[model samples]
Target: MIGKRVLSQEPVTLAEVKELTEAREKEGELTYEQTLTMDYCNKFAKLDKKKAEELIAEVEGLEKLSRRHAISLSDLLPSNADEIKLLFSKEHFVLSDEEISKLLDIVGKYKG
Candidate 1:
């Protein structure tokens, strides 16, 4: 197929990627790039399967948050509002203290 441009947007998690990669590898279903990416994520993902899933669930449930930002929160797991604010610095948006506190509380739950 020929195309001028394609715009794609989707939300995904490292845990999901790992699971898919494992399945693909078992079935001999992936390309070289996919295999390499999966290997790297398995080695470097910040949270393990369980914690990552939990955080993704909690963060995505927040109305003010995007799935992408939720993934970042799962990855960084910031402890303070200041830290979270820094994560959001590139956005043309700001969160209230209460909102920041709520997000931090969710992040703290699985930190240990």
Candidate 2:
């Protein structure tokens, strides 16, 4: 008989982010969010709550989903591959085609 195993990864929670920033500030060191965003364009990559909320709102606006755009409650219906392609193509986002395919598949499976 083979043994069973489970794996888990830590999520990037808001509390962890606060602790890291406080620790670095105490040492007069730059925070990870600061360092990462110093050379970046959008502030969403900061990983802070305020910025994260703003980004969420912006992305929701772009996706044209409902104000209550919970992933679980989203209208995941792809309608067709062409609509999926158009929805993804309109954004200057960085996601692989494979990822898009998977999203489309999830929506199709759920709503079709």
Displacement of residue 75 (Cα, Å) in model 1 is 2.8
Residue-level lDDT tens digits of model 2 in 3-110: 965577543324235556556667896757655633342322224444444433443553444333322123233455566666556455644566556555544443
Residue 67, model 2, lDDT: 37
Please give the distance, in angstroms, between residue 85's alpha carbon in candidate 1 and its true position after superposition.
Answer: 1.7
Q: How do the predictions measure up, each by TM-score?
A: 0.72, 0.29
Highest lDDT against the true fold, candidate: 1
Q: Which whole-number lDDT from 0 to 100 does residue 52 have in model 1?
A: 87
Count of backbone collisions in candidate 1:
0
TM-score of 1: 0.72
Off by over 4 Å in 1: 1-8, 48-50
Model 2 ranges with Cα > 4 A deviation: 1-73
